[model samples]
Target: MKLAATAGGGLFLGFSWTGSLASALEVVSDTAIAAGEINFNSYLALSPDGIVTILSPNPELGQNIKTSFPMIVAEELDADWTKVKVVQAPLDTNKFERQVTGGSGAVPHSWERLRKAGATARHMLLEAAAKRWKVSAGTLRTENGFVLNPANGKKLSYGELATEASKVPVPENVKLKDPKDFKLIGTAVRNVDNHEMITGKPLYGLDFYKDGMLFAMIQRPTAFGLKLKSVDATAAKAMPGIVDVVTFKNNVAVVGKSTWQVSKARKALKVQYEAEAALESSADHDRIFKELLNSTDATVRRKDGDVEAAFKSAAKVIKSEYQCPFLSHSPMEPMNFFAHVRPDGVELVGPTQTPERARDQVAELLKIAPEKVTVQLTRLGGGFGRRLSADFALEAAELSSIIKAPVKVIWSREDDMTGGTYRPAVRYRFEAALDAKGNMIGYKLRGVGMNSGNPTREDNFPSGAVDNLLIDSVEHKSPITTGPWRAPITNFLAFAEQSFIDEVAHAAGKDPVQFRLELLDKAKKSPVGEIKYDIDRMRGVINLAAEKSGWGKKKGVAQGFSVYFSHRSYVAQVGEVELKDNKPVIKKIYAAADCGMVVNLSGANQQVRGGIVDGLGHAMYSNLTFKNGAPEQENFNSYRLIRMKEIPEVDVHFVHNGIDPTGLGEPALPPTGGAVANAIFKATGKRLRNQPFAEQEELKTV
Candidate 1:
C-alpha cells in the first residue's frame, strides 16, 4: 500500500491490479468533511487522517433492510462494520438504479451484486500487497479488511490500501465465499435500526420537516362517481392558522400551519356533491353480489373431466356461500407525504412502496422530466401492498405545487380509512357433487366482487382447463375504488375454496389434511389440466404439517388444518381452538412453510407471524361495511387490528431446502383464514362458511 501527499494536507492512495494477475490499488480522500447524515448504500472513502464515509440506499421500511443489505457488502469486503458510516441514496437512477424495494425480492436479488463489489475491492487490494512484496497474487488472501501474506506473516489494512486499491482496476468475476464459509450471512443478526425504531428517531415520512412548510388535509367526496357541485371555503379561510383553502378534483384541501388547524378547517368547509347513479349503499353491494352468483355471463376459468356428466350421475350435491368484506391496510402510520416544488425541479419524500412509480407520477403531474423529480422513499410503518400506489405522493406534490411552497400532506385516521383504496368485498358460491363412495365427482366455483384492476390471463382460465373443472367470476361494477389488497383478488377466492374443501371433508368423515392430500394426488396423476399449484410441493407441505402437528392426536380440543399454495410458496397451518364462555379462544397455531432458499430465516418467520396475526384479527373481529355508499368503519376505534392480548402461541417451522426463494409475505395470509375457520367448525360442529364467523348471530360450537 502507498499514500501520496495532496495540496491541502490531504492524502492520496493508489492500487493497481490485472485480471488473473498481480495488481496495485490507490485511493485519495480529504478529512475535512466531518461526520454527516448516514447513507449506507454508497462508497466509503478515507484520507491519511482516517475520516470515513458511506452511502445508504433504499427506504427504511419497518422490515429492516437498512442494515441487512449493507451487511452483505461489509461481510464480503471485510470492512469494519463498526467504523463504516452511512448516508441515504439520492434519487439518481442513472447512478443507483432500482432504488425501489418490495415483493420480498431485495435480499435475494441484491445479494450477489453487493458481494461482488466488496470482493472485487478486496481482491484488488490483496493484489496490491502481493505485488509490493514481489509475491504471487494467488499466495495472498484478504481477511477482515486486511490483505495478508501467510508465508511472510505481513498484513495491510484496507484503509492503508484504500488509495492503492482505487488505482487498481476492479477485478471482474471475483470469487464469492461459499455459504458454508460465510461468517455474517445465515447467522442471527438483529435489525440495525432497532435503536432508532424503538427510541422514536425521526426515520419515517410522518416525521419529515421542511422550512416554511404548511400542513394540508383533503376532504374527499363521500361516494364514488360523485361530482363536486360546489364548495365554499370562506369559513375555512377565516379560521386561525389556516393559510389557504383550495379545491382539487373530487375534493377540497385545507392548508394551514399545523395539522390540527388544517383538519379542523377542512371539516368546517361547506361542500356539496351530486351523487351518481352508482351511489347505492352497502345493501346494494350485497344485492349485486347475489345477482352475480345467478348471472350466466361469466368467464370460465377452468374445466375438468366431464364435470357436468359426473354431477348428473352423482348421488349427492352440496352447496354453500361465503362472503368477505372490504378491508383497509391500516398500517400503524397512516399515509403521509412531504413535497417541495422548486421552479427548476420537484423534491418529493414520503413512505412509499413503489418509489419508481412515485417518481413517474410526480414527473407526469409536475410536467417535468422524471429525472428532474426526486422521489425519496422513507420507512413505512407498514405496507401490506397498500403503499404500492403513489397516490399520497401525487396528492402532496399537487398541493405543494399549488402553494408554491414546501408542504407535507398528512391523512388523519379518518381520512386514511375512508379516502384511500380498499380491498373489495367479495362473495363466493361453491357447489360440489359427490359419488356414493364419497368421492368428489364435480366441483363448481363462482366468485363475485368489485373489479380489481384487470384480471390476469391466469385469472380467466382456458389455458390450463381441467377436464371437468368449472371456474367463473362475475364482476360487479364498483364506484368504490379498490387496489391490490394482498395477493391479487384471489385472497378471498382461495379462502372460500380451501374452506369449502374442509366442509366437504367433514361431510365425508375424512380428515381435512387427508382430503387435501388425496386432491393433490389426483391433481398429480391426471391434474385438472394445468392447475396453478405445485402438487408435489403442496402435498409435501400438507404431509409435513400433519406430521409436525400430530394431526390425529387428541388434546381435549378441536384443531383444523389447511394448506394453500400461492405466489410460488407453500403454507400449511393447523389452528388449535377451544370454546370458552361461548367464544372461540385460539390456543395455539402450528405453521409449516417452504419458501425455497430461505435468505433471512428471521425475516421469513416475521412474515409468517405477522400474516397469522393479521388473519386471526380479520377472521375474529374485522369487518368493513358501507351505508349509503360510504364506509362504515373509520379508525382503530371501529376497525379492529389483532392486539397482543389476542395473539395465539404461534410456532413457525420452515423446510430448509436449498432451492430458489419464493414470496414470504402474502402466501401465509390466505391459508390462515381457512385453518382458523376449520378449527371453529371442529369446536362447534356448526359449518362456518362465511368470514367474520364470530359475528354470525347463530354461531355455536357443537
Candidate 2:
C-alpha cells in the first residue's frame, strides 16, 4: 500500500500486490480513482476540500460498521468528525486481505491497521506545517483538521496544507491515542447512514437497478438431495414479458423483464425433480440422533481426569437430553444479486457477507481470472450468517452469462425459507455427577448433529471450567445443506450447557448467578486444562448483569440468568417473565457484555439487544421442520419470527475495559435462549428442554 498525489490534486492511497510502497513524489493518473472518488490507502482518502473519505472494507449487516470504521479513522487523524465521510469500498482481494464480515471480527482485525493509516496522514499534515513555519515537527499538534502551534498562536487548515502534505514522507510508524483521551470513541455517535435508511433510500442488493437488466427467479428442487429432472416451460415462455427459461443441475430458472413477471413465470412453469432415495423426514433425524446418543462409539473431543471413576463414586447423578430444531436465517431482505457478465469481465452488485468468496466463485464460474470479477457490496438488511454463502451471487452470475444480458436474481420469501443452507438441528445428552454435598464432580456431554462433520466444539463454554469433563460427538449425514447461524454451534450449545448448569445450581440449593460465579472462580484458581475464556472478564459481566437486574430481588417476575463467552467476548443476560395463561409473557431483559473497548456505545448496545431479540425469537417460535426432506414452513406464517408487539424492553450494559475491542455481534446471542428457558422454569416449575417452547404441549398445560 502506498500514498501518493493524484493529478486531480488529491491524495491517493493505492494498494499493490507487489508489497512495495510508492514515494510521496510519485504522481498517479486521475483514472485510478474509482467512480471519481480519490483512492485512499484502501481505507482513507483526503479531498482537496479537506473532506476526509474513509473506505469501510467490511460489509454492513446493520452492525453499524459504516459509522464505526470512519470514527476510528477520524479519532486518529485528529479530523473533525463532521467533515468525515464513510464510503463502502468495493470488494478487491488485491487491495484488502480480508473482506468477509461474519464472526464479528471486523473491528478487532482492522483497529490497528485503520488507526495507523489515519495517524500516518495526520503526521504528514504536521510535517507539512512544520516545513512551512521552519519549526520542528514535534512542536506542532493536530486539532480538528488543523496543525496548531500553541506558543505562536499559528494554525493551518488541513485543506490549506493538503497539497504540501501529499509531498511529505509517509511515516513508518505513528503514535495512536490512549483510550482515556478518545473523544469520538466510547461516545454515542449516530449511524452515518441513518438518514438514508430512514427515508427508504436504495442501499440494499434488492433495491439495485440497472438499465436493460433482466429479472430472474429459480424453482429449486422440491426436496433436499434432489436434482432437476424435467421442466415444462411452454406455458411460462408464452406469458407477457417472459424472455427465456434456463435449467441448471439443481433448479430451473425463469428470466423476464420484471421481478413480478419472472416470479409468475416461475410459478407457471411445471418442474419435476428426481431423488436417489426416499426423502428422510425430521422424525427420522430425531430417531437417528437418539440412536447415536445411546451408542458408546463416538469421537471424544475433550477428556480431563477420570470421568468414569468420578461418576461411579458419585452420590447423585443427573442426566437429561436436549433437542433444538433447525432454524432459518430469514433475513428481511431476501437473497438477491445483480450480475453483468460480459466478455471482458463480470460485475456483481449485491448484499453479501463474504464478498471475496463471492468474487472468487463468480470468477471460477465465468472461467476468468479472479481479478476480472468485481463485487460491489451494498448495505445488507440482515445476514445472521446466511449471506456468508455466495450461492445467491453465483446464481445471478450464471443467469447473466446464459441470457447474455445483465440480470438480477431475486429469491422470494418462500424461496429463501425453503432453500438450503440452514442451521443444523442438534441433540445433546448431558450427565452430571454430584457428590453428597451437592457439588458437581463430573460432567459428560454427547452431541449428535447434522451437516457439521464435528458436532461438538471441545473448547466451548464450561469445557475448561470443570474437572472430570468428557466431551464426545457424533455426526449424522444428511443431504440438507447446513451452515453457520449467528454464533454457530454456540447458539445451541450455550442454551444446552447453561440451562443444565441452572438445573445443577437448583439441585445444589444455590442461586443460578452465584453458582456460575463460583464455577468461574474455581476455573480461575485451578483450571484443569487450557482455559480458553478469561475467568475474570466472565465474572465481571456476570456480576454486572446481576447488579443491574437486581438479581435476587423479588419484582413479581420470575428471573432467569445465563452467561456465555464467544468470539472473544463475555456476556451475561437475565430474562424476566411472568406466566400469562400458561404462556411466558416476557417483561424485560437485562444484558451485560465485555467486548473490550466500545467503539460506538449506541451501536454496541443495539448489537447486543438485537442479538438477544434474535435468539429469543428462535427459541420461542422459530423452527424449520422437514417432512419427506421438504421444508414444512415456507414463509413467516409457519416459520414464525418475533413480532414488534412481542418484543420486551431490553436493557444493555457494557463492562468498561481498556482492552482492545473484540466482537459484539454474536456473543450476546448465545445466552438469550438459556436465560428465557430458565425463567420459564422458575415461573412454571417445568423445565423446557426443547426449543420453540411455544410448540411444546407440556408447556402449554403449565
Top candidate when judged by TM-score against the true structure: 2
- How does model 2 fare in lDDT? 0.86
Candidate 2 clash total?
0
Residue 285 in model 1: shift from native, Å?
1.4
- Model 2: runs farther than 4 Å from truth? 1-8, 11-40, 581-583
Model 2 RMSD vs true structure: 3.6
Residue 405 in candidate 1, Cα distance off native in Å: 0.9
- Give, for candidate 1, the lowest lDDT window spanning 10 residues: 16-25
Candidate 2 TM-score, C-alpha based = 0.95
Model 2 lDDT, residue 674, Cα: 93
Candidate 2 weakest ten by summed lDDT: 16-25
State how far residue 653 of model 1 sits from its true place (Å).
0.8
Mind sharing the TM-score for model 1? Answer: 0.89
lDDT of 2 by residue, 1-702 (tens): 222232345534543311122111244555565222344366777766667778888899999988898888889989988888788988766566678788989999988988888888888889989999999999889898889998799999876777678778777888888878888888899999999989999999989998889999999888887777888999999999999999976778999999999888888988887887668799999889889998878999999999999999998888988899899999999999999888777788999999989988888888888877777789998989999999999999998898899999999999999998899999999998888887788999999999766667788657776789999998888889899899998898899989999998898888988888777777878788887778889899999999999998976799999999899999999999997876778899999999999999999989999999999989888889999989999998888999999889999998987999998989999999999999988988989899898898758787
